[model samples]
Target: MYDVVIVGAGPAGLSAARMAAEAGLKVALIDDQPRIGGQYFRHAGVRRIGGILAPRFGRARYIHTSLSTLGRCGVEVLNEATVVEISADRTLTVAFRGSITQLQGENVVIATGARERVIPFPGWTTPGVIGAGAAQNLMKASGVLPGSRVVVVGANPLCLLAATSLLRCGVKIVAVCAPSRPRVTFNALLRLMRRPDIFLRGVGYLLMLKLYRIRMLSDYRVTDVIGDAKVTGVITRRFAEGLPPSEERLDVDLIVVNDGLLPNIELASRAGCEIEWEPSTSVWSPKRNADFETTIPHVYAVGDCVTASGVENSLLEGEIVAISIAASKDVGERGRLRRLSRLKWRWRRLQKFRSAVVELTVKESLDQRPLTDDTIVCRCEDVSLATINDALCQGVQDLNALKAETRVCMGRCQGRTCMHTVLALLATAVGKEPDQFKPPVPRLPLRPVKVGDWLKKF
Candidate 1:
């Protein structure tokens, strides 16, 4: 049994592991990916193997330094290890390669991170259509460009970063379509103005795009993606007030769409941790206190898994959670409250920035008219959105009732893709608010695990 088991290897997980190990706690860092860096700081190539770092110097350096520091700190890094289940007793059933293993830990830090949100449109499943974040992952981590010429669509700060990264990597951007309106909350704007570095970063992104002569379409939405196997172009419509309905076809090899991100909270929810829906990010995040401890004691969550904050905040949170856990064990001279206070200071600073950005960028609910009766909702299980609507029409208002009827959110993805859409449709059909509807039912084996591997636990 280890003193701490970190269930991811991103910036947050790495920072947590480093702190735990430095505090003399036995730390085991596990991740499904082949390397230490999770999606945000994804590192490619073998250690000591030669490869060119992505032009984003800060991100690349952070990943490299953190991995090296973790190694030096004696943290046992287990790459490509998937945690399939977490028991009440803190036993983690993990699948590594073709076998399964049970690992016990006194404390657990879940840093599973966030997945990019992609809203389906016509032809979205095509090969050339991918999430804006996924495009970044492909270019930054895999060293493979999503396309030579691309059209980026989204309203997040990450969308701008993705565009900048693509330009640095010599990928030509055809156009950027941002659906955000010019008018934002005054409070959010004021908070953003206070952070000069963040404001400067925003300016720098605009300047880079200007210098590269990339076309930008503010208040525009990608109505449809056009192509067969590969994307040839995207259909876009302007969102300005009093604007006539004009459709434009922008020629591009790839369409990178980013709506926003939702917490990858399946494991936490399945483990019976309370989840709270945040309208700002339009997703449920695991409930945690000031010290990052969840409703269930000893199960802490850090990083994007708990909040919609970005990488810097995630790393700070990880450090805080680790210190808190260490203090609980009386491993160091530092008191828990004192360590927590320091973390709170940093967290407050970052939260101001995150709140401002989220307020300014989160997508408002667009026209989500329910899909046809036969339209598929859960792509993983091929469950139709039509079937889900039919169940709701038959008075199945509760999520569990709908689950029993249509099994829309009961697939392998476990409602990750269809939950929000299903809830929205149900609310529309029943004349209730989306938040008023019951949340999706949580289940175990939060991630897909082989049946044979699960049986090994017995």
Candidate 2:
């Protein structure tokens, strides 16, 4: 049994493990990825694309130092361990190396991070269409270009960053299309002015676009990623009507879609944490106190898995939680508490910037476009918007009844990709708030496992 078992090795979990281990706590930091660096810290050097942008600047020293510190402090780093289940008893059922085993923790910290919130439109299921973060992983982790010509579509700041990174790698960026009105962007920019660092970051994205001579399409929205078997190009149109029936077509093989992100609350919720809907981001997150512990005692949550705030907030939260744990054991709590308070100040400032980011980002996007009746809402099940609409029109009051009638969320993904759309359309059709509808319960065996593998003992 370990004193602390962190479910994710992202920035939050990494910092938490570092602090906990330095305080002489037995730590077990687990991650499903091959390495410890989370998606945000992917190749953490200031230079983009592993120094392709400039001839100088080596890999980040801090990343190496952080990971090394954990080893020196005797923290157990468990990479490629899939946490199958997290129980309220502080027991974790982990699938380690094709075999299942149980690990007990005196205290558990959840930091599973976030997943891309995909808004499906016509032809989005095309093979060449991928998430912006997926593109980043492909290029950064595996060193493979997504495509020679790419069109990064959406209003997400990450979309801009991904496009810039691709440009640095010599990929031809056809265009950057974000479905936002001038007024909406202006309002968001006005709000962001309160946070100069974030405001400048936004400006830097625009400056990067200007540097690359790429036009920002505030007027146009990507209607479809047109392709056969593979993505050949994309179809974009201006929102204004009677504009000569013109459509802007870019011949790009890869289309990266960005529609913001939502916390990966599956594990936390399964652990019986109380969840509340966040209207700003249209997602649900665990309810935590000032100490970052969830409603469940001894169970803590931090980072993007809680709010998709930022790495700064996540790192601070991790350290704060570790300090809180140390305090319970009477191990250097006074000094740690002082450090936590200082970090709290930084966290408060970061939260303001995050609020501004949410205001600007989730306001409008390519996801705003209404889906055609025949558009496939659930790609995993091949369920179309028309089928869902028909079910709603038939006065199916209950979501389960709708699902029974249409098999909407019965896909392999179990509604991860399409639940947001399902809830929105259902709420709109029933004339109720989206929060009123209960989401379908997530089942176990999140990743498909062979029955034989499950039966194997440790």
Over 388-450, each residue of candidate 1 has an lDDT whose tens digit, in order, gives 766777888677778788777777777887788778777777787776754554566667878
| Residue pairs with clashing backbones, model 1 | 373-386
lDDT string for model 2 (265-381, tens) is 888888889888988888888999988989999999999999887677778888989988888877854577788788787777677667778776735532367568888988888
lDDT over C-alpha atoms for residue 72 of model 2: 99
Question: Considering summed lDDT, which 10 consecutive residues are worst modelled in model 2?
Answer: 50-59
lDDT agreement of model 2 with the native? 0.80
Candidate 1 lDDT for residue 344: 79
lDDT of 1 at 44: 65
